[model samples]
Target: MENTSTRSTSRPSATRVFVARLVGTGVFDPLGDAVGKVHDVVVLLAHRGQPRAVGLVIEVAGRRRVFLPLSRVTAINPGQVITTGLVNIRRFEQRAVETLVFSELLDRVVTMRDGSGQVSVRDVAIEKDRNRDWKVTRLFVQRASSGPLGLRRGETFIVRPDDVTGLAGSLGPQSAAALLATMEDLKPADLAGVLADLPLARQVEVAAELEDARLADVVEELSDDEAVALISALDAARAADVLDAMQPDDAADLVAELPTAKADVLLDLMQPDEAEDVRRLLTYDGYTAGGLMTTEPIILPPEATVATFLAQARKAETAPALAAVAFVCRPPLETPAGRFLGMVHLQRALRERPQQPLGSILDKDLDVVLPDDSIGTVTRLLATYNLTALPVQDEAGRLLGAVSVDDVLDHLMPDDWREADDAVTDEMIERSANA
Candidate 1:
């Protein structure tokens, strides 16, 4: 009766927290005095599950850092981060960072069971059933790193994902932190093959998901023909987006291969100058120097310094289309016919004496091809000089573009047509499905 007449006992809902507010917060000492700032929060999550923070990363001095458990957080507000536990900063710094369990570090470098070697994991194969939770079925070791661990030994170490200790059933700070930092090192060619094998939809999704810089690197690795085919397969809008993300010259080259109507639609979607440059290339015969060359060449005045070149390189928003060599041009827009000078190979530009004038190092005998030169002729020039690239000029000796060795190779030996036949099988399957 006495209790019934009194106030009811109930717990209030906990306050919610947002990531933006948590990112940069001031940590305070037990006395409520400001001490440090939180640098990052470590979160852990279940496989393909939501992320949740469990620990705080605090930076004390310029270099000193420590981890604090979320359980110690007393209050979290826009203005400050308060903790209830009193801990010495020096002691926290001295504490060893916890070692993640072998299973928790899947897809990371880990020692083999034999203790004979190390291997990097590729992926974690998992199993799931309607009635049961998904569990890790096996660990997939990269083929290159599986040699030392015999097949039998590798099979024995595969752990169930659900059974993984230290990392499973948690979507806290540590897991989120680990996931963000995790990266796979893949060769460009290998990555390209993997992307190519994915379903068309998935391929586009993956391409769209990648950061621009990484996408640029992947594009640089693809053969010109492969790049053209990939771009052409995408819908006009998406293809244009990828092209716009690419170097101006690369964008132009791919656009040049498209059918006129489609090409125009894509170009209209691109930036004005880029569209104009690509249109200029489109006017040339596909096999000619003008067609093969990129207009976005790196050009510098003869007086520009190596330091200046490096600075320009750092500031450049995109890689130059034809940067294998940097041309040193004369002032007042003098044509080579007026007073011919030399070209500066990029390697020479980087290593040449800083004080030496660029004119002194010009390769005056640099081979030049006319815009109308045949692909066969270009191939010969490439083989005869072992040149990686050659400049293209008009009859008046005005620079128009430059052709790369890779382009010449594409014009010579094309990719085996067998793969195209396989692609036909896939098309047949899709048609059958539709029917």
Candidate 2:
């Protein structure tokens, strides 16, 4: 390896290393004894300038991880890293400001400085400065083929960081087929944990490949900050589509975190009915029943048969809590219905004849809460009734929406429930990649 930076007389030429190839390479001590293996390269991204490589995340014995600061690095060899014998065994925790080069930078999309178009980052080359510090200076990128059939491959080349436009900003589109394949067996909640472990750039890449419905489920499982960041990274059209796919209350919650102008833009781009539902949910304080209720709960007219309610409740799209009962209303069956009548539990429906009118056996005595009611009131009512969901009504006795137990739990749980790091393991990713 050779140094790409300017030569200096004060120190021997520094080594230029490609981060992707550096991972898994052995780290050796002065006496050439193996110490550990490199797992990732850490870099500090400044507001304006090339990112400086600060250190390496290495895996020692017992599957313990540790940080190896660049200052302790001595030399870069063909397939091994030379470091000072002194090593700290503390576990590595990625700070908010630090980025892992291989997991974050590789496969990122950036625009060429010459206006050639967008390119995907294949690898990044880092070299030591005159002071023996490492900094990312070269990007190995590939432009998408413009051929008639895309039969020809894109051109691949290396350029300085200044030669690209979007490397320092929010993430852009990239191919995520491989990464998605690695997650093929994961459920949405488990998949969300794996994604949370990834950097924002990788999250955006995977988001671009996921179907809107699946993406919506995964986003709902993320923390507020993580959800907002991932949603904001997608293009406007797709972002609105994803919002439309999400439940009204969840969509409203995410939009509430975005800037006012951006939120308005996305809501306008969404389907009219979907946007209206989310808009109504956003009007109430987050701690009120109105904010936690979903506008799409299963609703039926008084004349609807028990059979009809059963089919509606069985739809795969209906949320589990909301599907536990069917809300029977007057003339209009949609939300803000003509008049709130009663609810029919699925258990009761199963015990009655299919031809029986839902209203005939409905639980008119079911407890209800006003939209303006506090979350505490809603929680007490649900617990008091042992109900999975409770109806919200207006002063005129019109049904507005239904608040499910999941909605209350989402607010009551710790804010970082979805960020548990152990949800996905390094061994899982390695096996998936190899498979």
Candidate 3:
């Protein structure tokens, strides 16, 4: 979205506002009731262009922080701010192209454009551009002291952002820590995009900072090459832990991308239970039903009650596609479940009495695919039946995992689908339409 956070560059120009002064300022709604305090200013930083102030991070009641898009702000006066009162409650997330001014740029040391010595940044000034965009235009800096025992305070001056170097370079751990805080609200796919935009060193740093489970989710959304590179960058113990946290099918796919020896080493390091499932998946051809299916689909005995099924489906960890249908089998409820019976769609279960058995509402007529079935076959079966997930069974009628439509689409899309230009164009189109 286009951010108009600063006052318009009009006939009477507004004063050059130093972002440091805005922190801790009280933010109020249209009715003059206090809502929150400004904690930080978010800016869109560009390598060769002016950095635009996009929004303010405001700390509300309960100490929760939310992003206040510049478009929502009505006025920015000394010691106080006013908003349109309509605010999104979602937590603030820093996009890949953006940075937090206070957390990243303050106290940064930069070299002067001329042959003069280096200076440390004290604060930055932002103003509305000719195009009405709020941009960082000047820097407040202090030259290094050259007096006896460094007792004298260094001279300070206001200089253009272009008057110094090193401002755009990495800011070390502080940058990564702030970036991680902003990333907490991002989805795995979006987080992967953010990681992809970083330099290799920064990518590794951020990946290392993530918890194993979160790292696994993000890794699954990355391209094979990127996934391998990221995994390789981690220490063996942590890498195996992340792989263990990943879904079996996804873990298998990533493992297959690694060198044989490295893959073997990682698999050995994984928990036996998790490693077994991934190993089984690795044996299947990438295009087949066994390869694309997640081994953790919801499986229950034929006698499971509607209430029981509903509870299982409602778990926070249950994937929507996998939860849409539950498989009914004989004695062994786990995959390679014994004597596969019919399946029960969630819709069918919802209409039945809580005490009713799943078997009584079984969808027996639905056809199933085998482990060796082709991707095209799996796709056609799902489309033909309009199913979110399709069961895959063996000749002996034993149930294996089910192939989800999402997994099928993942394979069907191009290798670089995440970085596709078409997606970028579509997003731009959407933003323009919203604007």
Among these predicted structures, which one has the highest lDDT? Answer: 2
Summarize candidate 2's per-residue lDDT along 1-435 as a digit string, tens digits: 112233332243348888878877999999999889987799987768778999998877644558999899988898999999888987789998997776677777887666667777777888998877798877777767553434346667677788777786556456775446545778888678667767676788788889999999999888899899998988999999999999999999999999999999999999999999999999999989999999988999888999999899888789899989999888677787879889999999999999999889989886668999998899898998889999999988999999999999888654644432333344444454476
Give candidate 1 regions above 4 Å deviation: 1-184, 219-238, 247-249, 257-259, 310-324, 331-340, 417-435
Q: Model 1 over residues 189-226: C-alpha lDDT tens digits?
A: 54564444333444454566565555555665565666
TM-score of each: 0.50, 0.63, 0.64
- Candidate 3: clashing pairs of residues: none
Which RMSD values do the candidates have, in order?
A: 21.5, 11.0, 11.6
- Which candidate's TM-score is highest? 3
Q: Give the poorly placed runs of model 2, Cα more than 4 Å off.
A: 1-92, 95-173, 419-435
TM-score of 3: 0.64
TM-score for predicted model 1 compared with the true structure: 0.50
Q: Which 10-residue span in candidate 3 carries the lowest summed lDDT? A: 1-10
